[model samples]
Target chain A: MSTATFPEETRARLEVDAKEIIGRYPRQRSALLPLLHLVQSEEGFVSAKGIAFCADQLGLTTAEVTAVATFYTMYKRRPTGDFHVGVCTNTLCAVMGGDEIFAALKDHLGVGNDETTEDGRVSLEHIECNAACDFAPVVMVNWEFFDNQTPESAKRLVDDLRLGRDVAPTRGPDRLCTWKEASRVLAGFSDGRGAEGTQAGEPSLTGLRLARERGWTAPDPDRLPVGDDPEGGAA
Target chain B: MSTGTTLTPVLSDNWDRPESFTLEGYRATGGYGALRTALGMEPDALVDLVKASGLRGRGGAGFPTGMKWGFLPKDNPNPRYLVVNADESEPGTCKDIPLLLANPHALVEGVAIASYAIRSSQAFIYVRGEVLHVIRRVRHAVEEAYAAGLLGKDVLGSGFDLDVVVHAGAGAYICGEETALLDSLEGYRGQPRLKPPFPAVAGLYASPTVVNNVESIASVPSIVANGAEWFTAMGTEKSAGFGFFSLSGHVTRPGQYEAPLGITLRELLDMAGGIRAGHRLKFWTPGGSSTPIFTDEHLDTPLDFESVGAAGSMLGTRALQIFDETTCVVRAAGRWIQFYAHESCGKCTPCREGNFWMVQVLDRIEHGEGTEADLDKLLDICDNLLGRSFCALGDGAASPVMSSIKYFRQEYIDHVERGGCPFDHAKSTVWGGTA
Candidate 1:
C-alpha cells in the first residue's frame, strides 16, 4: 500500500487516457491490464495512487487491482530505472551464454537481480523467454530487443545507457525510449514508431531465403486436384 | 542436404522484404485476397474449406482448426469472440513473436476472416506484454486494416462487421493456455478455469468463443487464398499444410524454417549446416521445452504431429531447441524446471508444490550433492505432478526432467561421481572463454 498520490493535473490527464482504453474493451473491467500499463507509464510503476485511480475508473476495489497488478511480472511496485536491461536466462539462452551475460552485467553494474543502479540509469534482471530464441543470448532494454548478445556487447550497451549515449535495439525502433514511454506504448498508445525499423530480422528470413535459393514454392492453388470436396467438406 | 521435402514458405514468404510488416508490402503479395474471397462466401462454406484443409492448431496442442471453429452453438444469445493467443512465452518457443514482428498483417487478415467465419463481431489479439515492438507492429497492422476498410463496419461492403483489438498481456506464461487467456483478457489474474464447458461452449464473457494460436490464425489467410488442396498437398495425410520450424541454439545456422509438416530433423539439420563447427548433436527438444527432449537417434523421425508423437515427443510449435554434446543435460533440465517453478500460477496444488520440490532436487543433483536415490525421488515427484494439474504447465514441467533423466541418467551419475557438472560451462558459451 503506497501513501503517495498523483498530482491533481496528472490524475486528470490520466483519466482521459484511461477512459479511452476503457472504451476499447466491451466491459470496463477488461481494461485492467492496459490500465495498469497506463498508470505504470505515468509514475514508472504502479503506485497506490495508480491503484486507487484504476479501482475508481473500473469500479473495483483496491485489493482487486493490487491482485491483478501483482500477478503480472511487468507491473513494478517500486521505481524502476529509465532503462530496464533484461537478460534472457531461460534454458536455450542459458546454454548459449545468457548466464554469462547476466553474471557479467551484475558484476559490471554492481547490482544484483532486479536492482537498479545508483544513478537510476539501468535496472538489471534475468528474464524468462522473450521468444527471440533464434537470436539466443538475448538482452532487452526497455522491452526492445538487443539480439545475439555476448557479455562484452551487453556491457557496452549498459555503459552507453548510463553515459546517455544513443543506443538502438537490434530490431524495431531506430531509437530507444525510456521505460515509461515503452509502458505507454504497451498501454495501446502508439509513439508513432510502429514502422520505424525493418519488419523482419535476419534470422527470421532464413526459411524464405532457403526456399528462394532452392526454387521451392507452394503449389499453385488454381491447379488443384478436382473431383474432390470443393468447399473442403471432409469434416 | 537434398531431402525429398523442400521448404514451402507461405506465411513467412514476404518476411525478407524490409516492409513486410506494412500494408503496402503485404498487399503487393496478394495478402488480403483471402479475406476478399472469404468475405464473398457463406461463413459455413469458409469453415468447410478449413476443415477440408486439415490444418491443425500451430499452438502446442494439435487440435483441428476447423473443428474448433465449428463448436459454437447455432443459437448463441451473446456475442462470439475470437481471441488470438500471441503470448509466445514457452522457453524455446519463439516462432509467434517473430511472425508478428515480420508479418503482422497476415494475422490481422486471418483474424478478420476467422472472426467472420465464427460469426464473431469482436476479436482480440492477446500478445505478451514483454515484446513492445511486436505489440506495436500488430497494433499498427490492426489500425491499417481498419483504415483500409478491411476490418471495421460492413467490411468490404459485405454487410459483415468486425472490430479487432490488440490487447497486451502482463507477463504470465500460463496465459498461453486458452482458458487462462480469457481470464486475463477479462482483467482477472491469469489462472486457468475448470473446463467442463470448453471455450467453444462458454468462454470470454460467458459466450461462445474460439481461441486460436497466432500461427494458426495467420495460416488462415493462405488457406483461404490457396484452397484446401493446396494446403493438404504439402504435408502428410493427417498433418496437413506447412508450418514454421523454429531452429534455435547450438546450430550452425539457427532460424525459422517454414517447411511442410512431415520434414525430418535429419533433413533440417543438414539444411541448417549441421551442429556448430567441431561439435556433434547430443540431445534436443523436438518442440519447445514443454515437449520431451530427443537425442540424435531420433533425428530421422518425421517432424509431424503423429510421427513425433509416435517417437514419444511432440511437434510442439515446431520449436526445435538443439543442444550439442558440449551442453550439460543436468544443467539444461535444471534451468527449464526453474522456469516452470517460477511460472506455475499456484492455482493448483500439484503444479505449485511439485515444481518447487523438483527444483530443489534437480539443483542438488546438478551440484553433485545427491545420491542415486534422489534421481528416483525426482521421478517420483514427476509422477505425482504429471497428469494431475489443472493445466498443462505441470505436464510441461515434467517433460524435460523425465526425458533428460531417461536419456542422460549416466550423465547424472557422472555428475555425482565427478562431484560437479562435468562439461566446462565456458566451452558451451558463445565466446568459448572466460572473461
Candidate 2:
C-alpha cells in the first residue's frame, strides 16, 4: 500500500460520509462495498490511500479491503478516464454486432480493452451483459445505456466524449454524468436525475403496447371459479 | 394458438406511463394498495395466500416462494432478513432492470409486504452496480416511501415496522446466486457458501433470512390484492401465474412479453412478427445462456418448470434469446463460455479450472485449429462441471457448451472442415443488410 493518505480536509469530509455508510448496516464491515464506491468517486480509481481510508474507517486492514476490491470487476486498480466506455460483447450482443463495435471503438480511440485514451477522456472495456438484451449490441458509457448501437454510432459516441461534446443516453438522464459522479450515485447519494428521462423504452413496453392495441386485459380475479388446480399440476 | 387472451400484465401494466416511476404516478395507479391490504391480514395468512397462489421463484430456480419463506425456523432468535436479488446479470435476462427502471415502487411495496410476512423489519435490495440509473430509481423510491410513511417504523400507522435499504453490487454474475449475494452484502468476496443451514437458517450475519428474486417478490403484492385463484387461472395447471418472456436477438420486435407461464415460444414468436424479415429460427435458449440451448424443433415446448425440464432444459429466467440461420452456434457457445470463465469466483475447482480449459478448447475448435476429438473433450469438461461445482454457476457454465454440441454437431464439423466459423458474422448483426 502507498504511504500517502488523503489530505486532511478530504479525509475529514470522507469520514463523515463513511460514518453514514457504516451506520446503514448492523456491522461496520458490511460497509466495505459502498465505501469502495465512495473512494472511487473521490479518486477516479480506488487508490492505495483510498483503501487505507476505507480500512481505517471500517476497522479492517488494508489487505482485507484490497481482497474485497480485487474480487469485483467494477473496482478499478488504477486510474480511469472521465468516461468508462463498455461495449457489451456478451453472446447476444456479440452476435448482433457488439464485437464489431468494440473493435471499431478500439480503433477509433487508439486504445485496447480497459485502456484509457492518452487525453484521459475514455476507457474502453468489453463488458458482460448489462441486462438490456432487447436492445441488442448495447454500449454503456459510465454505466448509462447507449442502446441499439451500430459500429459507426459507437465510434461517433466515443469521438463526442473525447471531444467533450454534449452526449445524452437513450433512456436514463438527459445528460450523461462523469464516471466519478456516477460512482457517487452508486454509493447511495442521489444525483436528483432519477426520474429525469423516459422511464420506459420502447422495447421495454412491447408486450404492454401490444396488449393495449389488442384490447387484452387480465381476467377479473373476483370472477374466477373455485376448485382450480390448487397444487397446480404437481403430479 | 396463443392470442392476446394469453397475456397478463400485472407487473408490466404501468410501465408504459411516463410518470410510472414517481410515487404520485404509482399512487395514481392504485400503488401500495396491496401492502395496506396485507397489513390488515395476519402474516401467516399472507404466507398461506402465497402458498395457495402457486407463485414460484422467477430467478431461474422455480422454487415455491411461500415455501421458501416457510423454511425460516420458528425457534431462531436472530433477526430475520429479506434480501431481494436485483442483480439481474444473466446474459439475455433483462426484465427486472426494466421493471425497476419503470416502476420501482412495486418492488418496494412488495418488500414491505413480504417483510411483514417473514416478520423481518429490515430488507435489502442488491442491485448490480452497472445500472446507475436503476439504482437511483430504487433509492428515490425508498426515500419517497419513507417520506410518505409507507416505510420505517409503524408503517402507515398499522404497527408494522419496516425499513428498506437499497445496496448496489459491484459487477459479479455469481452474486445473483442467493448465498453469494448474502456474502457480498456482508462485505466479503461473493463466493457461494455451502448449504446445510441454507440462507433460511444461517444467512446475512448468521441470521435467519428469506431471499427472493425481484420478480417473485414483486408478484407478491398483486397476489395479495387478487386472490390465489386469479393467479392460478391464467397459466397452466402447474406453472401458474404470469412472467416476463424477454425476447432478444434477431427477432423482428424484441422486448419483454408478460404472459402466463407455459406459453409456447411458437405462439410468442407469432406475436413478435416471426423472425426478422426472411430469416427462420435456427436455435434459441429456453431461458438465459445458462439453460441448455434449443433449436426450432423445441419451439412448441411449454415454457414452464416441469415441461421444459422434461424437454431437457430448465425454464430459467425466461430470457428467450432467439437466433436465426445466419448465426453460428459454435461462436455463440464460445462467447458464453468466455463469459462464465471470466465471471467464475474461483471458489470451486471444477467450475474455475474446467471453464478455463473449456474456453481454450472451444477457442481452438472455433478457430478451426483443432481435431474432431475436441467435441468429446468439450463434453467431458461439461460433465465435470454440471454436477460437481460448488454452486449453480458451474452448471450454468456447462449448459450452452453441451447443448450447442448436442443440437448442432454438424455445425462443429463444418467449423472444422471450413477452418473457421462457417457463417458470416456480418449477416447476423442489426445493421447487416443496410450497409
Query: What fraction of correct interface contacts does each candidate retain?
Result: 0.86, 0.87
TM-score of chain B of each: 0.98, 0.98
Question: For candidate 2, lDDT tens digit of each residue in B1-435?
Answer: 334346788899998775999999999888999999999999999999999889999999999999999889999999999999999999999999999999999999999999999999999999999998899899999999999999998999999898788999999999999999999999999999999779999999999999999999999988998888888887877788999999999899999999999899998998788899988899999889999999988888888988999999999999999999999998999999999999999999999999999999989889999779999999988988888977899999989988998999999998888898887899999988332
Cα-lDDT of candidate 1: 0.91
lDDT of 1 by residue, B1-435 (tens): 215888888888888775888999999999899899999899999999899999999998999999999999998899999999999988888899888988999999999999999999999999999999999999889999999999999999999999999999989999999999999999999999899699998999999999999999999999888788889888877899999999998888899999999899998888888888888889999889999999988978998998999999888989999988889999999999999999999999989999999899989889989788889999999999989988999999999999999999999998888888888988887778222
Q: What DockQ do you compute for every candidate structure?
A: 0.69, 0.82
Tens-digit lDDT track of model 2 for A22-98 = 88998778899999999999998999999999989978889998999999999999999999999999999999999
Clashing pairs in 2: A232-B237
* CA deviation > 4 Å runs, candidate 1: A1-4, A224-235, B1-3, B433-435
State the lDDT of candidate 1 residue by residue for A129-210, as single tens digits. 9999999989999999999999999999999999999888998799999999999999999998988887777888887888
